[model samples]
Target: MVDDNKFKALVNKYVELSDQIAEVGAELVALRKKKDAMGELVMQVMQQGDIQVLELTEQGGKLIRRESKRTEALKKEHILDELMLLTGNDATRAQASLEKIHNKRTLVVKDALSRKR
Candidate 1:
């Protein structure tokens, strides 16, 4: 009886926490959209003005524009093609081998509570 009660309490706590997290997640998505939009606007304004640093005396800070370069992401198709080359251009065998490796990977499971609509 005690164990059952403890389990029930934990499940209730989990649901409550999940609800709070969901609310916060929605707010975070909205905030990120706004931030991205503002960043785009700032980039456009700085580029138009040919400005590197915008000093705000009242705000006591400045915005600096910096450039960055990075390579593209390593996609699944690229990896599969490389694997096919290694497997002597045997696409089917390579795919099967990859699937076997994927299936052998360890997975962790935990108890979770969700609200039913």
Candidate 2:
């Protein structure tokens, strides 16, 4: 003899926990927004003041942030031609090669809520 009351109570508790999870997720999103804003502010201040490292209070850690300015990049449109020129116009017997080697593969998984239409 199974109790209907216990089963219903279990379902109610599950719904309550699901709602709590959503609330916590929202809080996390809000916290991330504030954190990103603070980071941008700190970077702006440092760049404007021509500063590198900013020392904080005794309890706080020092923040060392800098903008990386890329000086040059290999042109992809001229890669084969560039390789051809370097190889003395011989690709089959060329010692140099224009190659892009990927070291690893990454897999991404996303979780989203879908409503039935």
The candidate that wins on TM-score is: 1
In candidate 1, residue 109 scores what lDDT? Answer: 100
TM-score of each: 0.62, 0.45
After superposition, which runs of candidate 1 have C-alpha atoms over 4 Å from their true positions? 76-117
Residue by residue across 24-107, what tens digits does model 1's lDDT show? Answer: 999999999999999999999999999999998998999899898999976668778888999999989989877786678699
lDDT of 2 by residue, 19-112 (tens): 8888999999999999999999989998889889988888698989866797576554466676678778887533234443122335579997
Look at candidate 1 and tell me the lDDT of residue 33.
100
lDDT of all predictions:
0.88, 0.73
Q: List the residue pairs that clash in candidate 2.
A: none
Q: In model 1, which residue pairs have backbone atoms overlapping below 3 Å?
A: none
- Worst ten-residue run, lDDT, model 2? 95-104
Clashes of each: 0, 0
Output the TM-score of candidate 1.
0.62
Q: Pick the candidate with the highest lDDT.
A: 1
